[model samples]
Target: MQIGYFLSCEEYAPESLIQQARWAEEAGFESLWISDHFHPWTDEQGQSPFVWSMIGAISQVTSLPVTTAVTCPTVRIHPAIVAQAAATSAVLTEGRFILGIGSGEALNEHVTGARWPATGTRLDMLRESVEVMRALWQGDFVDHHGEHYTVENARLYTLPDTPPPVYVSAFGDKAATLAGEIGDGLVTIPPDADLIRTFRDSGGAGKPVHAGYKVCWGPDAAACVSTVRSMWPNDALPGELAQQLSSPKHFEQAGQLVTEQMIDESVACGDDVDRHLDAFRPYVEAGVDVVHVDQMGGKRQGSELEGFFAFYRDEMLPRMRELAG
Candidate 1:
C-alpha cells in the first residue's frame, strides 16, 4: 500500500498547503491527495482556496504525484472545463496527476444557482460528465448532448501524452459498481471491505482503491479529540446528509448531534503510534492501494506539524511500509 498525505483545502491557506506538501514529501509520503471544495464545512475551519491554482503551485514545489481527494465536475463546473484543467495539471506535474471525481454535494453545486437534483439524477449526470471529459481528453472537437450536459465544439488544446487517470469516488454499493465499470480506480473515505468487494465483483479488479483516514497527532489525546469534534464534526454526519446539505450553517447545525464519543471512536487522535497504525490497518486489510492521512488539528505548523511528520517518518511510515511489503 502506498502512503500519502491529504491536503485539506478547507483548513489551510495555499502557502501552508504547499509547505505541508513539501513536508509530506520530506517525511517519505509517496503521494498526495488534496480536497477540492468551494466552501469550508464550518466557520471554524475557515479557508477554501481555489484547488486548481493550488495544484499548479504544488506541482512546482514537489515531486510527489497528486490527486484531488474528490472533485465534483458534474454541477459547479462543466466536465469539459475540468478535463482541460486536469489535462493542464497533468502537463504541469509532468503526468503526475490523477483526477478523482464524484457525483458532488449540494454545498458546492448549489452556489451556481442551479437546482440540486435528486441522487439518481446526480449520478446520471456524473456518468455523462465522465463521458464528456473522456471525449474532450482525446484532443478532438467534442460535440455531446447528454441528459445532463451539452458540449459543442470543445477541444482540449493542452494535454499530456497520456490523459490522467480518472478515479471515481463512491460510498455505496451502487456507486461502487459505477466506479468499477467506469473508473480507472476507486476513491472512498472509509475502510469498508464490503464496498471494496462490490467494486471488484462489479469489474474493478486490479484497479487502485484509495481511501483517506484522519488523524490528530499530539501529546494530549483528549485535547485532540476535542479539537476534532469542534473542527470536523461534520465528518460524523450520517448518510446522504453530507451530499444534501446546502451550506456550512446547515452542516454546523447537523454537526451538533455528533458526540465526543463518536469522534473518539471514529478518528485516530493523539500521539499513540500503535493507535495510529491501528486506525490505518482496516484500510490496508481491506485492500486499499493507497491511504492518505489527513491531520485534523488547526494550522499544522512550526513544531506541531514538524513533530508529526518526524514521528511518521521515523516511527510510523516504516512500519506501515513493512506491513505493505
Candidate 2:
C-alpha cells in the first residue's frame, strides 16, 4: 500500500512548514495530505493557515504529491471557484495534485453567515457541486442549473492538460455509493470494508481508495493518548463517528467524550511495531489504495516523529507493503 502523511499546516512559520514536508518526503512517504480547515477546531489548537498558499509552497518545496484530505465546495467556497483553485494548484504541482472534497462542517462553513445545511441537504449539495465542477473542468463553457448551483458561460481558463481527479468523502452507504457513482476516487477515515464494496457496486470502477489512521508514538504511550483525547476524543468510539460528525455542538463538547481508553483504541500510541501493524491491517484488507499515516506527534510539538517514522519506515511499512503487494 502507498504511504502518505497528513498535516494540518497549523504551524504558521514557512520554514517549519517546508521542513515538515521535506522531512516526510525524505523519510520515504510517497504523498502528502493536508487538512483544509479555516479554524483549528479548538482554540487550544492554534494556527490554520491559508491552505491554498501553503499548497503552492508545498508544491515547490517537495516532490511528493499533495491533496486536500477533504475540502468543502458546498458552503464556504463556490464550486466554480473551487474548480479554478484546483486547476491552478494542479498546474503548479505539474499534475501532482488531487482534489479531495466533502460536505463540510459548521466550524469552517459558518464564516460567511450562511446557515449550515442539514446532512441530507449537504450531501445533495455535494453531488450537485461536484457535477458543476467536473463540467467546468472540461474546459468548455458551462451553462448548468442544479439544486445547489447554476453556472453560465463558466469555464476554467488555466486548466491542466489532464484535470485533477475528484476524491469524495463518505461515512455511510448512500454517500459511499455516491462516491462510487461520481468520484474518480474515495477519501475515507473510517476503515469500513462495507463502504468500499458499496463504492465498487454503485458504478464506481476499481478506483483509488485512500484511508488514514492516527498514531501517537512516544516513550510514554499513555501521555500520548491523553493528548489525543484532550484534542479529538470522539475518534476513540468505534461506531459513533457518524453521530459525532452530525452533532449540533460537537466541538464545544469535544472534551467531554474523549478519554484515555478511547485514544488507546483508535491510535497506535505505543512503541510496539506489532501493535502499529495491527492498527493498519483493517484498511489494507478493505482494499484501500493509499494508506495515510498521520503522525499525531505534531500535537505533542514534534516529540514523536523521530521514533514513530523510524519504526514506521524500518519495521511496519515494509511488512504492510508486502501484504498489500
Candidate 3:
C-alpha cells in the first residue's frame, strides 16, 4: 500500500505546507492530499485558505503528487472554475495532480446564501457536475445545460499534456455506484467496505482507490483527544452529519461527546510502533490502493514529528508493505 499525507492548507502557511510536503516526500510518502474549504467549519478551527492557490504553490515547491482530498464542485464554486483550476494545477505539476471531488457539506456550501440541498439532491448534483467538468476538460468548445449547471461555449485553453484524472469520494452505496460509473478513481476517509464492493460491482474496473485515517502521535492520549476536540469535536459523534447539522450551535455541543475513549479508538495516539501498524491494518485488508495517513498533531512540532517519523517510517510503513504484498 502506498502512504500519503492529508492536510488542511489553512493550518499551515505556504512555507509550512511546502516544508511538510518536502518532509513527507523525503520520508517516503507517495502522495499529498489537502482539504478544500472556504471556511474553517467553525470559528474554533480558525483558518481556511484558498486550497487551489495553495496547491499551485505546493506544485512549485514539492515533487510529490498532490490531490484535493475532496473539493465540492456543486456549490460555492462552479464546476467550470474547478475544472480550470485543476487543469492549471496539472500543468504546473507536470501532470502529478488528481482532482478529488465530492458532494460537500452545508458548513462550506451554505456560506454563500445558497440552500444546502439534501443528500439525495447533492448526489444528483454531483453526477451532473462531473459530466460538465469532464466535458470542459476536453479542450473543446462545449455547451451544456444540466439540472444543476449550465455552460455555454466553454473550453479550457490551458491544460496539461494529459488532463488530470478525477477521483470521487462516496460514503454510501448509491454514491459509491456513481463514483465508479463516472470517476477515474475513488477517495474516501477509511471507506466502508460495502461501499468499495458496490463501486467494484457497478462496472468499476479496479481503478485506483485512496482512503485516509488520522493519528494523533502524542505521548498523552487524553491530551491528544483534547487537542482534537479543540478543532473538531463533532467528529466524535456516531451519526449522519446532516442529522447533527440541525443547529449550527450544536457543533460545540456535539464536540462535548468526544471523549478520550473515542479518540483512542480511531487515532494511534500512544508511543507503540507496533500499535500504529496494527491501527492501519483493516484499510490494507479492505483493498485500498493508497493508505493516506493524517498526522493530526497539527501545529505541535518538535517531539511530535520526531516520534511520528520514527514510528511511521521505521515500523508502520514497512509492515504495511508486507501486508499489502
The model with the greatest lDDT is: 1
List ranges where model 2 is wrong by over 4 Å: 10-15, 237-252
Q: 277-315 in candidate 3: lDDT tens per residue?
A: 777888877888887887765565446755666667777
Predicted candidate 2 versus true structure: per-residue lDDT over 224-265, tens digit per residue: 777676655545544533333433246537557666775676
TM-score for all models, in order of appearance: 0.98, 0.91, 0.93
List, in order, the clash count of every candidate structure: 0, 1, 0
lDDT of each: 0.91, 0.79, 0.78
What's the true lDDT of residue 46 in model 2? 61
RMSD of each: 1.1, 2.5, 2.1
Worst 10 residues of 2 by lDDT: 240-249
Q: Give the better candidate number (1 or 2) by lDDT.
A: 1
Positional deviation of residue 304's Cα in model 1 after best superposition, in angstroms: 1.6
Candidate topping TM-score: 1
